[model samples]
Target: MTTLAIALGALVLYLIAYNTYGKWLGQKVFRLNKDHIAPSIELEDGNDYVPTKKGIVFGHHFTSIAGTGPIVGPALAVMWGWLPALLWVLFGSVFIGAVHDFGALVVSMRNQGKTVGDIAGNVITPRVRVLFLLILLIALSLVLAIFGLVIAVVFRLFPQSITPCLLQIPLAIVIGFFVHRKGFNILIPSVLSLGIMYLSVVFGNLGFLADSNATLAAWPVMTWVTLLLAYSFVASVLPVWVLLQPRDYINSLQLISTLALVVVGLVVASLFGGAPIDGLRPPLEIVAPAIEQNVTAKQLPLIFPFLFVTIACGAVSGFHCLVSSGTSSKQLKCETDARFVGYGSMLTEGFLAVLVILACVAGLGLGLNKGDEFLTGTAAWNAQYSDWASSKGLAAKINAFVTGSSNFLQSIGISATFAKALMGVFVASFAATTLDSACRLQRYVVQELAGCFIDFKHRKLAEPLKTEKSFQARKTSWLTNKHVCTITACLIAWWMASLPAIPGASGIFGQPGSGGVILWPLFGATNQLLGGLAFLVILFWMRRKNMPIWFISLPTFFMLILPAWAMLYQIFVAAIGSDQSWIEQGRWLLVGIGSATIILEIWMIVEALISWKNLQKTAIQQD
Candidate 1:
C-alpha cells in the first residue's frame, strides 16, 4: 500500500501544482493573452508554422519532450535508490522542469516562434546566439543519432512491438488528411485511429505478423539506422500536419492510455499481489533498497550533482526547452495554451517517471525468472540491479523497465505477451517521436545558421544587389531551403552514427551508433546547460519587458550552475583529479569535446553578464 500511496500522492501533487503554480505562471507571471496573435497565425507558413488546436499541440509537445529520457534517466538513477529519484521527479518537475518548459514556450511564442537559440541574439548577444546555436547543433545531433538506434534496438528486443509502431505512420497520415484537408472533425478520426492502433497491438505478436516482426528484428542495426534517418529526413521536410503533428498527437494518445493502464495495474497490484509466479502470488512491494547501502566505484554515487544530472528528463532537462521553442511554439494557435502544452506536459512526464520507479522497485518484486529458477521479491529486483555496472547498458535498462511494467499490466488480467508488447511499443514509439521531432528541430537550427552565413556574405552588398539573380546568390539561398537544411541535418547525423562508437574498435561497419556513443559523455551536461541558457534568455526577455525577473532568475542560476558544476566535477574531480583520469582510459575525444562545451557555456554566460550590466545601466539612466 505504501507503493500505492506514493504513486497516488505524486499524481495528486501534480494536479495541485498544475492548478496552482502552473496557473499562476501562465496568468499572473507570463500573462498569456489569448487575444495576442500567435506566430503560427502571424507567420502562417502552411508547412512548419501551421496554427493548431491546443489539444493537438499538447499531444505533440508532451510526446516529443518525453522520448526515452524520462524512462532511461529514472531507470538508471534508481541505482542510487528509489527515494532520491522519486523526490527529484516529484519536486523537480513541478518547480524546475515545468517552469523551464513553460517559460521557453511563452518566450519563443512571443519571439514569433523562433527557437530560443535564435532568440538568444536579440535578448542576450549575437555572440551568445552563435554559441547557443552551435551547442544546439551538437545536442540535436546527439539525439538524432542516438534515438534512431534506440528505436532500432527496441525493435530487436521486443519483436512484437515493431508492427504496431510501424503501423502508426499511415494511421496518423490518414487522420491528418481527413482532419486537415477534408475538414472532417478531429474527434471521430482520433477515436477510430486509437482503436485501430490498439487492435494492432492486440494482434501484434500473433500469426504471420509475429514472423514478420522477427525477420525485421533480425536485420542489421546499420540497415535500420539508415532507413530511420531517411524517414526522419522526409518527415522533417514535410509540412507540420502531414506527419510530425498528427503522428505525435496520435502517439500521445496511445502513451496516455498505456499510462492509464499502468496506473490501474498499480492499483490492482497494490490491493492484491501481481500475477502468480510459479503458481504462487507474490506481494508487490518496494524491493530495492531505499538507499543503496553499499557503493562501488563502478556504481552511481548519490550526491548533490550526480543525482541531478543522472535524472534529467524526469526532473529537468535542457532538451525540453528546445522542444518548447522549436516545434510546439510554432504550432500554438494562441498564447493562452502555453501552460497546458508546456507545464502540463512536464507534469505528465513526471508522473510517468513515478510509475517507472514503481515498476522497477516494486513491480519487479512481483516476479522474474533466472535460468531454471524463478525469483520473486528482492531476488527478482536484485537480478537486474545487483551491481550497477552489470545492467547499465541501454538494453539492460530498458529490459528492467519492460519486465517490471509488464508485471504490472499482468496484475490487471492482461496477458503476459500482450502486456510486454504494449510496454515495448510504448517505449519504441516514444523514442521514434523524439527521433522525428529532433530532426525537425535540427533543421530549424541549421536553417538559422545558414541564414546567418548568407547575411555575412551579403553584408557589404547594396540593398538591390543583396537579392542578386546570379547563380552564386541562388546557390546560397538553397542553404536556407527547408528540404536542403533537413537533408543536411539527417546526413550529418547519419554520417556520425555510421562511425565506430569506440575509437580504434572498428570501422563504421563494426558497431552501430558508435559516433553518438563516443559523444554520449557530453550529452547530459550540455543538455542541462541548454535549459540554463534558455532560462537566461527568458530572464533577459522579462527584464527588457520590465516584467518581474525575480521568479525566472532563480531557476536560471540553478540550471546554469548545476550543469557547469557537474561538468567541472567530471573534468577536475572525476577525470584530471583522479588517479586514473580519462587520460588513463585514453578517451581523448571525450576530454577534448567536453572541455570545449564548458568553455562555450562560460563564454555565453560572460556575454550574458555583460548584457545584464548594460541593462542595469540603462535602467539607472531611465530612473
Candidate 2:
C-alpha cells in the first residue's frame, strides 16, 4: 500500500474508534456518568484537584507526555522498513497505548485521585504496590538516562540549536512570570513566547551564536550533563505556573506547527514527488538465511516483538502510566474527564505517528532509490547504500530538510523565522513540565514506601500508631520533597548519558541504533506486558462493577500473547550465540528485560491472588 493510503486509513480508523467505540467504552464500561464525582471530592486540594476544563487539561497532558521519545522512536523505526513501523504505530496506539493510559487515569480517579503506585496497593495489596514501585523506579531511571543521550546527540549534531534553546529559558521564565505574576492570560503570553522563540531559531541560522564563546561555545560532555541535571533540578522545584505550565502551553503550539509543517511537506512530496507503483519493495527480499534464521531461531514470531517495538508512543507507553497516575489523577476534578483527555489525546498522537510514517513512505524513491535502499538490512547494503547515496545527492537533501532550509521554506519564508524564534518557548515549557510531573511521581513512591516502613516500625502489640499526616508532611518537605526527587531523577539521567559519551561505552551496550534491536523491541514487548497487567487490573475493576469482561479481555489476551512470544524469541536469540556482535547484544538485552518483567509479573500475580483470597474470606465471614 502507498504511504498516502496508510495516512488516510489511519485517520479514518482513529476517528471511528474515538467517535463510536471509544465513546461507548467511556459511557458503558468506564461509566463516565455525570452523576459520578471524582472520589477526590471528599479531600480536594485546589492545586491538584481543581475542576479542570477538558481541553486545557488535554493540552497540558499531551505536552507533558510528548517528549523527544516520539520523534526518536519513529526516526529509528525507519530501519525496520516504513511499513512495519507504520503498522505498529497505527495499531498499537489504539489498542495498547490508549487503553493503558486512559485506564490508568480512570482507575486512579476511582480511588481518590491516588497515584498509580498507591492505587495498585490499595486496590490490590501492599505487596503488589511494592513490586510495581520497583518496576517503575527502574523503568523511570532507564527512561531519563536514555533520553538524556537522545538530547545530547541532537545538540552534538546541531550545535546551532544550542543558543536558541538556551535563550528560550529566560524568555519562558519572563513569559511565565508575565502570566502568573503580571496577571496576563494565556493568549498574550503564548504569542509573545512563540514570537521570541522563533527569532532565536533565525539567530541560530545566521551563525550569530555559532562562534560566541560566552553562550555558544561547545562544552565538554560533562558540562552538558551537569547543565541538563541542573535544568531538571530547577524545573522540578519550580511551580507549574512559573515554568512547567506556561512552557507546555506554548510548546503545544510548536508541536502543532511542526506537525503541520510535516503534513505540508508530505503532501507536497507525494503530489509533486510521486513514486512508481512499486515505490516500496519488501525489505525482506535481500535478507540472508543467516539473519532470517537468527530472527526465527530467536523464536520471535517476527510479527510479535517487531510490532510491539516499532509502535512506541501514545499507546501503551509505561512512561505515560506514571504521569496519568502521578499528578494528572490528583488534578482531575471529574471522573468522566479521563476518557476525553487521556484516551482522546493518545488517539491524536497515534495520528501524528501515522503522519510521520506517511512522510517517510512519500519521501522514499524507487529509482535512483536513495531513501528506499538505505532502509534495507544487509551489512553490505548498509555500506553500499551509504556510499551510493553520498555519491548521489541524498546526503545534501537530507541535510537541508533536517536543518530546516530546504524548499520547505518557500511556502512560509516569514512564518518560518517566527517559528524558529519560539524554539526555546517550546523546549523549556515541556522540559520543565515533565520535570515536575516526574518529581510528583517520585514523591508519591517515596510516601508509599515511608508508610510501609512506619507500619513495620510499629508492628508490636502496642497501640496502633497513627502515621498519616506526619509521614506525609515529612515526605513533602521542600528540602526533602519534590525538589530532591527531581534533582535525583535528573542526576541519574545525566550519569546515564555520560556513559554513552565514552569511546567504547556506547558500543559497550551494542551498536548505537541496535539498542532498539533489544531496547526498543523489549520496550515494546514489556509495554504490551504492562498492558496485560493493566488490562487485568481494569478487568477486575469491571467485574467489581458487575460488567462483562469479553470486550476488554479478548483484545488484552491477544495483545499479551503476541508480544510475549515475540519477547521469548528475543530471549532465545540472546541465550544462543550469534556471531554478530550487534544482534547478540540486542538479544541479551531483550532477555534481561524480559526476565525482569517476568519476575515482576509473577510478584504482581501472586499479590493479586492473595488480595482475592482475602476478599473472599471477608465475604464468607460476613455471610
Candidate 3:
C-alpha cells in the first residue's frame, strides 16, 4: 500500500503541477501567445527546421530528453535511499527541471530557434556566448561518449533487445517517407510501427531470433560503441524527417505503451504482489532504507550535493536544456506548444524517474528468482543494491532497472523471458533515441563553434591567396561542413569510450566497459552545471524582456549553486585531492576534463555577475 500510494501520488502531483504551476509559468511568466510564429515555420529548411505538429514534437522532445538519465540516475541514487531521491525528483522536476526546460525552449523559440548558447550572446554578452558554447561542446561530447557506451552496454546486457531496436530504423524510414513524401495519414503508419516493434519484443525471446541475439550480444562493448557512433553520424547528417523526427515520434509511442504496461504491472504487484514464487509473495515495499545506514563515506559518500547531482535528469538535468533549446525549440509549430513540449515532457520524464525509483526500491522486494531459489523482501533488494560499489558497475546499474521492471511485468502474468525482453528493448530504445539526438545537437554545437574560427571567407577562399598563411586558413572553413562536424563529434566520443583497462571485468552483465561508472557521476555534475548555466541565459533573457522572474531566479541560483558545489568538491576534494584520486589511478583524462569544466563554469558565472551588476548600475542611473 505504501508503494501504491507513492506511485499514484506522483502521477497526481505531476498532473496538478502541470495545470497549476506549469500553467502559471506559461501564461503569466513567459506569456506564450498562440498567434506568435515559431522558428520552425519562419526558417523551414526541410532539414533542421521543419514546422512539426505539436504531438510529433512532444514525442520527439520527451524521448530525446528522458533517455536513460532518468533510469540510470535514480537506479543508482536509490542506493542512497529512496526517500532522498524521491524528494529531489518530485520537487526538482516541478520547480527546477520543468521550469528550466520550459524557459529555455521559449527563449530559443523566440530567438528564431537558436540554441541557448547562441542566444546567450544577444541576452547577456557575446563573451558569454562563446563560454556557453564551449560548455555545451564539452557537455554534448560527454553525452555522445557516455550514451554510446550506455546503449552498447544495454545491447550487451540484453541481446534480445537488439533486433527490436534495430528494426525501428527501417520502420522509421518508411514512416518518414510516407508522411513527408506521400502525404499519408499518420495513424496507420504509427499503428503498424508499434505493432511491428512489440512483435519483435515478444518473439525476441523465442526460437531462432533468441540465438541470433546472443550472437550479436557477444560482440565486445568497444565494437558496439564504434558501430553505434557510426550510426549517430549518419543520423546526424540526414534530414530530420528522414530519420531523427520519425524515429523519435514512433519510439515515443512504443515507449509510452511499455511504460503504461509497467505501470499497470506495478499497480497489480503493489496490491497483490508477484504471482507467488515458492508459495510466498511479499507485499511490495521499499526495502532499501529511508536513509542508508552503516554506509561509510567510502561506500556512498556525502549525499548532499552528490544526491542532487546524481539524480539529475529525473529532477533537472542540464542535457534537457540542450534538447529543449536545440532540437525541440526548432520543431515547435506554434509558440504555444512550448508548454506541452518543454514543461510537459519534463514532467513526463519525472514520472518515469519515479517509476524507476519504485522499480528499484519497491519492485525488487516483491520477488527475485535467483537460479534455484526465490528471494523476496530485503534479500531481493540487497541482491540488486548490496553496496554502492557493486551497484555502480556499468552493467549492474542498468540491469537493476531491467531485472526489477521485469519483475513488475512478470507480476502481471507476463512470461519471464518476454518481460525481460520488453524492458531490455525499452531501455535500449531510450538510449538510442538520446544517442541520435545528442549527435544531431552536437553537430549543431560543432558547427556554431567552428563558425567562430572563420579566417577566410567562402567568397574569397577559391580566389588566389598571396601567401601560404592565407591558404592554411582555408582549411578551417572545411571543418564547418555538416558531415565533418557530425563525424568529428562521433569520433571523439568513440575515442573516449574505447579507452582500455576500465575497472570492471566479466561481471553480471558480461565483460564490463566500466566507463559508465567513471563517467556517470562526472557527467551528472557536469550536466547539472550546464543546466544551471542555461538558467542563467534564461534569467538574462527574462530580465531583458522585463518579464517577472521571481520563479526563474530561485531555480537559476539553485541549479547554479548546487552543481557548482558538486563539481568543485569532485575536482578539489574528490578527484584531485582524495585518497582514490584520479592521479593515483592514472586517469589524467578524467582529471584534465573535470578541471577544465569547473574552470569554464566559474568563468561563465563571473561573466553573468558582471552583466547583472551593469544592468543594476544602468537602472540606478536612469532612476
What is the lDDT of every predicted structure here?
0.86, 0.56, 0.83
TM-score of candidate 1 on Cα atoms, chains taken together: 0.95
Runs in model 1 with CA error above 4 Å? 460-476, 503-510, 575-579
lDDT for each residue of candidate 2 in 331-450, tens digit (9 for 90 to 100): 566777888878887888787666544433333221122344433234423332232123122222223223221222222333433433333233333444554455446655655655
- Measured against the true structure, the TM-scores of the candidates, in listed sequence, are 0.95, 0.77, 0.93
- Candidate 3: stretches off by over 4 Å: 279-281, 370-372, 455-476, 501-521, 575-579, 583-586, 621-623
Best by lDDT: 1
Order of candidate numbers by TM-score, starting with the best: 1, 3, 2
The reply for model 2, stretches above 4 Å from the true place, is 33-52, 78-80, 178-183, 212-217, 274-301, 364-440, 460-480, 494-528, 558-572, 575-594, 610-623
Clashes of 2: 13
Clashing residue pair totals per candidate (backbone < 3 A): 1, 13, 0
Please report how far candidate 2 places residue 516 from its true position, in Å. 13
lDDT of 1 by residue, 527-594 (tens): 88888988898899999999887877788899899888877777655641134446556777777877
Total colliding residue pairs, candidate 1: 1
Model 1 residue 146 distance off true place after TM-score fit, in angstroms: 0.9
